[model samples]
Structures are given as structure tokens and as C-alpha cells.
Target: MKVAMVASHYPLPSHREEFVARVHQVADAFRRTPGCLTADCWLSADGDAVVSTVHWESEAARDASLATVMTAGLDIGYDERESRPREILHLVAR
Candidate 1:
């Protein structure tokens, strides 16, 4: 089944630019992974939050890609820049 994952982060104002840059880089890399249908990054109008939406071919594919990315340490350190922990939501195509 197709899966969509949404991740949101609230980075410190001073770090928002760099955080967005890093997210773009990471999204680009993720888009290249197998089974990744699309990856997009968005910035909130208020300038304090960044959101990423990634669509994958399947749940297994998404899980595998995430495990690989995490093991490779390519998971950007949002914790370092964000005032609070990132939030994630996973949904299946109906």
C-alpha cells in the first residue's frame, strides 16, 4: 500500500534557515531512495516551522528506507536546532 509520512519541526528562530537547508538536502537524498515516490519540504508562513511530506511505494519500503537513512546518520539533527522534538504522522492511501 502507498504510504505518506509527514514530519514537522519547530526550529529556533536563529536556526530556521540552516534547518530548512538541511531538510532540503535530506529530502533530496530521500527522493533518490528506492520506492520513494516523492519528497517535499515546506516552510510555515510564520517562519518557525518546517514540514516534510514523503510518499512511498509501500510501508515496508518506507520502513526500510528510514532504517537505512537512520543507520547512515543522514537523519538531520532536528533536535539540535528545534525548540521541541519533531512530530511525525504516517497514513495509508485509502
Candidate 2:
């Protein structure tokens, strides 16, 4: 199972490195929480938005991980927030 998280903030870019380090720290704190395969992060060129993805071994794992996230107060409300499927029409041509 794959989950994507997108966030935006005025100062998010300035603290990208700090944010990434903290993300790792949080993942470590929840190491035993199950359902977390890995988390990867990306930043926009303009430095205001960020996108992250998490892959779980299974749907059950994803659900469990989400539960933990909620319990852990892992909420970042954007100036604008959206929850929708990011359409991927095609993969690599190769």
C-alpha cells in the first residue's frame, strides 16, 4: 500500500533539512508501530510545498500506521489542503 502526503507552508522551505531530520526521528520513534516500510520526502523548487510518500507492506499495515500517525498528532494543515488521488496515467516508456 502506498500513501502520499502533501503539505505547504510559508516557511517550510527554509527548514527543509530540519523537517526531514525530524521526520526520520518520528519514524524511528514509531519503529515498533508496524506498517511503515519507508518514508521519502520531496520539496518544490519554490520552497513552499512538500510532498512525501510512504509505502507499507500491506493495506492493514497502512491503516495501522495511519492510526499511529493520528495518535501522534501528525497533522499539517495547508493554507490549502486537498485529499485526492494523484492520477498517474503512464509509467516509464522503457
lDDT of 1 at 44: 85
Clashing pairs in 1: none
Q: Return the lDDT, model 2, position 82.
A: 29
TM-score on alpha carbons, each prediction: 0.90, 0.50
Please write out the lDDT profile of model 2 over residues 10-75, one tens digit for every residue.
334455566555555555544556756666556668755444545566666767876777678653
Residue ranges of candidate 2 with Cα displaced over 4 Å: 1-32, 74-94
> Candidate 1: which stretches are off by over 4 Å?
none
**Per-residue CA lDDT of candidate 1, range 1-94, in tens?**
9999999999899988888888888788778789999999999888778999999999988988787666666647656668998899998998
Report the error of model 2 at residue 79, Å.
Answer: 6.2
Give the clash count for model 2: 0
> Which structure among the candidates has the greatest TM-score?
1
